[model samples]
Target: MPDTPPEFSESADSDAVAEDNEFDSLRGILADGVVGAAGGLVGTAMMTVVFLIAQSVGAFELTDFAILMELLGLSEVVPPVLFGFLLFLGGGMVPWPLLFASLKAYLPGESSPVSGAFFGAAMWSGFVLAFYTGQTGLSLVLYGILTLVAHVVYGIGLGAVFDYFETRPDSIV
Candidate 1:
């Protein structure tokens, strides 16, 4: 028999356990960022579906894409719609996810999805103000409702992706 009991021998101090956890390592942090980006991309796709449906019904326009094209002056270089979409996807896949990850701790929720939904709602307020299309009457109302729903859906998708990765036994996060 060993001198130390197996139970006590393998036990670690709280500090050691905390230090040894995945998030403390650089590799783990990078892994989490990649995972978060994937989640954000998924979320963006979900939001795009909502916008596409709205566009089909004439309730919405590709205002964001147009704005991006104008701001970047990429209209002459490439098709405004295509360039705008690529930019949008890039934005969704990186910065937004990074922001979400940074703020996840402060957002109120029992799970990532709930917190993400809150984050999306918060983001929508800014978007509504910044991207106002001068819509009025019922058009404005529909736009508001649809955009809000889309943002919430995006958050859910983002959070679901995080939740999925986190639940895996071999997850880096």
Candidate 2:
């Protein structure tokens, strides 16, 4: 009786809506992952610089990268310093933001600077401190103080960058 078939029209409309929803979901995931990765990389970079500066200034004499490689018995390849930087980039820089993003839903407090600082402290105490202490026999008092400060700085940088990108008018996440 009508020019359009009823079944075909209904199915097509439903399909279009379904497709749109799927696309939106995928877009949200991509946006969040990209923004989080960017934030993590930047934060790690800042942390590395601060640590290096402190090391040069004779704050403490320990190399996390070297200790990690030695602990894993991988120090024979190239040099420990080179491998340490690579490990720091891959292990340290890449994971923080991703972990933060994954745990964003459960992270206490709003995603503000204070919250970021707290997150950084948690990360240092929970992960970094333990690792260094076990692997390198780090001085709990000295190394802990340095790492706590550095991790807090890193967290602040990560949070600031993520907030900036997330709040942009065209941000998709």
Candidate 3:
């Protein structure tokens, strides 16, 4: 006996629900991407600090920035530290989070620290090993070890931050 048809009202309700669901899905994707990027930045920052400390203590004696500068033909134009910073931001901070977010499903241990550490090792194998193994000198071995440790630390930080943010719906909103 209502003025409105029952079919019209039912369809409207279903449409609203569908729209809400779509919005939620989009929001989730956005949250994941943003959180993952932030985590990567943090991890890279921590790695940088660790490397600096190692250098100061004479435990490590490699300059990846120097190598990078030479490779890019920027050795004459820019200092290694400056170039290194840019590389760290771009290479370590930007890509890692996105990579983690994309590969998280396939990574073992359900986003835990262990899984993150494993992911770090995977990254080392894929990126670090491929790039650094060809370099010459005793520093290479020391640098390689230091880089391995740093990458693992980075992974832990990346995973922890992502997981923390992922679990908190209110934080994303």
What is candidate 2's lDDT per residue for 1-173, written digit by digit as tens? 46877766645687667655754797777877777777777777877776776566555444656766776688887588668667766765567777776666676668745566777888887645434533233444546677778788888888878779767866655
Best by TM-score: 1
lDDT of 3 by residue, 1-173 (tens): 46878766645677667656754797766865677778888788877776776566554544656666777788788887578568766776667778776787788886656677778877877546534635446566656776688778888888888778767756642
Q: Name model 3 segments beyond 4 Å from true.
A: 1-31, 57-59, 126-142, 171-173
Candidate 2: worst-modelled 10 consecutive residues by lDDT? 130-139
Off by over 4 Å in 1: 1-26
Pairs of colliding residues, candidate 2: none
lDDT by residue for model 1 (73-153), tens:
878788887788888888888888888888888999989999889988988897777667777888888888888888888
Per-residue error (Å), model 1, residue 100: 1.0
Query: TM-score for each prediction?
Result: 0.83, 0.71, 0.70
RMSD of each: 4.5, 6.1, 5.5
Question: What is the full ranking by lDDT, best candidate first?
Answer: 1, 3, 2
